[model samples]
Target: MEEFVPSAAIAHFVMKVKDVESSYAFYQGLGLRGIDKFPEMAIIELRGGTHLLLAAKDDPMAGALHASRVGQRPDFISEKIDLMIAGHTRADLEKYRAELMANGYSPADIAEAPLYGHDYFSMLDPDGHGVSVYTSHCGDKPV
Candidate 1:
């Protein structure tokens, strides 16, 4: 099979954000292409033209089952990470970590993942949604 940069298979996905401006800046820093920006919302385009819609939400996690407005805290069974970027190399992950650090963001150290035997790192956007960037273990395989 021919190896190609995969385009997003869907039209868009949304991240309820606390601040559009900051969220916009944050994703932009991570190399997602900027599309449109608004006071209440912003859109960042991924490699295949899929849009990551960043819309303002007073409490982005308010609707989360792990959290609640009026009830006992619940033990969450799911991860906070909503997006993953795959096509990076181990060295690319290191470079990205350094770049984020220099820009005043705290990103997790590159760690080895046994799943695909690749390295990855996680970071939080301004609104606190988790994003993971990792080396592609797909090699010549179509993913």
Candidate 2:
């Protein structure tokens, strides 16, 4: 009998936003092409075949989805969520940072980490979720 190896990959990343439409617009401005849209939810495609699901806080499914995490704390605030995006090269990371800045997004200044062997920049989405753009070192060599 062959051992079953799980092929794991991120299919969708769901996030609760205060206003679905506004948050959708925010992501659209960042070059994420919208794949589907609904009154209380939206699906945006990222670069690496992963989809971002944005759900309105007031949506019923959103409530149920986060119910376990919230427990009895109705006022519980979600801890900072990091959405890391990878670029093909260091220049690609810098280009994304520059484009974000030019489009009025105030991303943190780019920084390099020797330990990680990559360059990265961080920014906050409309709902204050952390979004980071980076170029990885332990992957196919950059073109």
Candidate 3:
């Protein structure tokens, strides 16, 4: 069989949280474009126009789609990979980390991944979802 390829991209990432406003602010703080927000939901746009849908835990459609979902607990922190965003370079990661810190967010110090040799840092969002920002590393060599 011949190799198959498809041109597809992510359109939306749905997240349920107890406080839509808080989650919305977090994404906006990360420089993601926010397309207005209400008490129940928010639509934040990524660079590729991908929308990160932050829905209130009790949102009708969100509740219907999932049997159960939990919100963040102040005492617990999740270190799992919830989302990963790529910057143009390692310097971008450093600047972004500074911005996050200025905004009162304590992101971990940037470090290089030994396997990939790209810089990255992780922080918990308002909903306790782990988010990683990394320097972009695509393809095998220069284009």
Q: What is the lDDT of residue 1 in candidate 2?
A: 57
Residue-level lDDT of model 3, residues 16-118, one tens digit each, is 7779988888888888898988768889988656788787876786765344434635354333433345556777778878988998999988864532666
**Tens-digit per-residue lDDT, 1-143, candidate 1:** 56686664777666667788888888888878999987677899875567887767754433452233255334532224334455557776687679889988898888765346667878777666778776666566554
Worst 10 residues of 2 by lDDT: 76-85
Stretches of candidate 2 off by over 4 Å are 1-6, 67-76, 79-88, 112-115, 141-143
lDDT tens per residue, model 2, 64-100 = 5565544445564542344444565667877887887
What's the TM-score of each model vs. the native? 0.69, 0.74, 0.73
TM match of model 3 to true structure: 0.73
On TM-score, the stronger of 1 and 2 is 2
lDDT of 1 at 47: 57
Candidate 1 residue 65 Cα shift, in angstroms, is 20
* Index of the highest-TM-score prediction: 2
Best-to-worst TM-score order: 2, 3, 1
Clash totals in order? 0, 0, 0
The lDDT values for all models are 0.69, 0.72, 0.71
